[model samples]
Target: MNEALQLLKKYWNHDNFRGLQAEIIDSVVSQKDTFAQLPTGGGKSICYQIPALLQDGITLVISPLVSLIKDQVENLQKKEIKAIGLTGGISSDEVSNLLDNCLYGNYKLLYLSPERLQSDWILERLKNLPIHLIAVDEAHCISQWGNDFRPAYLKIANLKTHFPKVPILALTASATPRVKKDILEILKIENAVVFEKSFDRDNIAYMVFEVEDKLFRMVQILRKNPEPSIVYVRNRKSCIEISRQLQQSGISATYYHGGLSSNEKNKNMTLWTSEKVQVIVATNAFGMGIDKGNVKTVIHIQLPDSMESYYQEAGRCGRNGQKAFAVLLNSASDYIQAESQFLAVLPDKEFLTKVYKKLNSYFQIGYGEGIDESFTFNVNEFCAQYQFPTLKTFNAIQFLDRQGIVTLSHEFSQKIIVQFLISSKEVIRYMSLNPQQEETIVTILRNYPGIYEIPAHLNLVLISKKANSTQEAVLQILEQLQKKEIISYRANGNDSTIIFNEVREDERTINRVSKFLLIQNDLKTKQLESVLKYVSTKNECKSRLILNYFGEQKKENCGICSYCITLKSKATPAIAVSKQIISALEDTSLDSRSLEKITGQPSDQVIFALQELLEYKVIEILSNNQYRLRK
Candidate 1:
């Protein structure tokens, strides 16, 4: 324990562990199977990383997100700790070399995706390594009841059979009681020491505003706070739209989504994290492993699909234990749109079967064929060929992936490979003829070996730095070389991979997964309803509601939430008026005059309550100036 504490201070510059981190580390170091439910920003990585440093052998980390693996590996490397991340698109030679390094290179950690466990060769190689601990990040995904369940996680239980002497540490930020029990069962962790941290974040103040002009409200909130913040939207298009709007209002802001290249994402993230930009307007793709501790606000311009996602995202703020805010700006139309969108994407089983057949046909795979085969997928091209809606097509593909019929890798930017077509002699002659392009060509040749023999991945940023040029200049030179027939360049883009897990059988496969689909849909509906209830309930503490939903009971009301604040401000009459309006609208539609008369409240109070109901989507206005319960 003393050695672990010394390493913690040496590597992370922290004198002690936070919350249950020290205890979790002790459990792992004592060779106990442990289940840890830490809240977001609870330093879950430290719990395993410290033990990995103190132990005798390599620690295997099973992560679900590629970005997370990359982020952690980079951070560890910055501390001069030996670590590596393995994912798809690597050559077989590279995998062999990486595994060899794990065995002989004295590496402290090896991070890999869950999907990689399907490779028998990799599993055979792992069996030879001396693994001290096996850590599963995002362990909640192993449960079917979890919000982000992945079928591939089921394979993790077999690790015990391979590494019989290794202890396991399972960590997650958010898991319900059912999901917690499922994790224990699926991981086969008997006699495990479970460590659960409190879900309440007292430094964070939750607020939900029912606003007509969401954008306007967002701007107002930004102006009031004017600190480092994050604004989340629903889609990539809105990410750009809201960012531009904020920029136009004289705020330094940028947008980020999964569609952008790796360089672009890193640049935007750097700008925001370094305080060069005041805000980052992004989709939910941002903020997985980001470690910015001074983020003062996180505002959601749109409602998320589930409370689990919402809680995780909102918890990204207030990591420094300062007073931070998580605000939601919503309208009645937004609620309706969210519900309708959910329904629209959930295709029927028949439609799912049709999609399955079409997918196999698109890939030119015969029945009972294509098991373990991978294909490059172009979703737009596939949709165009089938004349299918893009969203529906994507949903069907995701559903199939969840059912283990296929494996769809997340969209990662492809590598840029360049190979010189001309020989070394020809390259020397061309460079002498074109003095301007000589430096870049020479730099590329020197930095990347085998450029003349085979295509090699190149980093444009590194090339430009070595050549004393800009990235644009490097690209221009590469294009010039391509035109002059001096090289072959493949620019980076979105090229995803899909692996077929079984033979193509449309109806049989669909029927087998139909019950799972129904269960998924029901779970989604219930999750959305829970979110709606959280936003609509006016009498309870917002923090209490979120904690209770996660099965935490006996929690006191957080005095700083929007509801508590309103209560303290003596707004009891308004609450009574809103409840009366909701109860009266349950029977039938009524005009404002009739509602006011029925509730026996003043006209001003009735109008206020009606507006609140409409904004919260508890009621809707009909064409005849009548209000009724929203369907």
Candidate 2:
């Protein structure tokens, strides 16, 4: 324990461990199988890291997210601790070399995907390493009941079969009792020391609002609680659009989603994390292992499919414990949209079987011949070629990927390379003719050397910034240049590559996954129903509903939530609130965002008052969506 504390003080510059970190570390160092259910920002890494340093051999960490593995490995490396990640997209040769590094590099930690562990070569090589502990991050994924269930995670049990002496430490930030039991059974971990931090975050005022204009409501919420915040949207397009709207409304904001290139994601995340931007509108992909402590708000513009994911994404805020808000914005139409999106994408057995056959045919993989074959899989192209519904097809492929039938490697194609077909002199001549593209051409030429001789990989964000152009314009210019045969360009943006882990079995393939597919479909339906029940139930406290969903029943109302505030505000009559609003706006017009502050009433009350006043022709809405007394 002394040595562990010393490592903590020396490396992390912390004199002591936080919360249950000390106890979890003690259990791990004593070689006990442990399970930790810490909250999102509860320092889960410290529990295994300190013990890994205390032990004699390397710790093999099976994590579900590549971003998470990269982050932890990089952070540890920054502290001069030897850590390496065997994340996806590496060649077999590279994998062997990385495993060799673990053998001889004195590396204390090796992080990898459970899918990688399913490989015979990787499994065999791992058997030789003196693994001290097996740490499973996102351990909740092992549970069929948990959100984000990855079928590959079940393979982690194989490690136990090989390294029987290794102490297994499973860690997850979110899990119900069912998920906990499921995870324990899947890991083959019995009599393990289980530690769970309470899921109740008293500091976070869980707020739910159903409004006709979600954007208007969101702007109001942000204005009311102006601090470092995140706004989660359902899709990539929303990430861009909402952030743009916020920016146009005079807020410093950015966007992030899976569709963005790595450079863009990193740059945007850095901007928001460093307080250069006050708000980040993002897709659900935005918050994995993201622990920015001072985030004052997390607003979801669209309802997530389940309470589990909503809880996780919303939980990203309020980590600083300083009165943060987790706000969910919804509407009557949003519920209909949510149902269509969630239920439509669910892959049933028949749908799964159809997709299975189509995928194999698309790849032209002969029966029992594509066991190890790999192919470039663009979801859009695949859907277009087969005339499958885009969302349903995507969900089907993902289901297969999770079933260990194929690996849909995202962020596997960030490399954008270009080479000039024409000579430098001809390129210069063409650039002279096309003055509009000259700066971008010059930027690419200057940044990437030997582009005339060979293909050189480049970053789109870097090129755009240097060229003083948008990425869209840059790509357009590149495409134009390609048409003229002045240069050959290849840009793969968030495209996925599929590697078949199983041979084509067609009916047999569907048969194997059918039972689980039905079960999973049922699970998703229930989850969506739970989410629907949550948002539509206007009478219940939002905090209590969410807590109860996670099996944390809180009888007391969180007085700051939308329900509690609304319940309390009903005591004041609508006419009385309207009078206050008129008085507050007597001297000047005000927008909805500011009316709540000036009227000294909750947002719901203020909005209701404004609606009534507008109906009576007592107040008028301006072109800018502000309210003023009628002439």
Q: Estimate each model's TM-score.
A: 0.80, 0.83
Cα RMSD to the true fold for all candidates? 7.2, 5.8
* Model 2 lDDT per residue over 433-518, tens place: 99999999999989987888889988888999988898778988989988988888897654677878777989998897777787
Backbone clash count, each prediction separately: 0, 0
The best candidate in terms of TM-score: 2
TM-score (C-alpha) between model 2 and the true structure: 0.83
Best by lDDT: 1
Off by over 4 Å in 1: 77-80, 84-86, 89-97, 119-124, 162-164, 363-376, 402-514, 571-631
User: lDDT tens digits, residues 182-254, model 1?
Assistant: 9999999967999999888999999987755567667877898988999999888999999999999888899
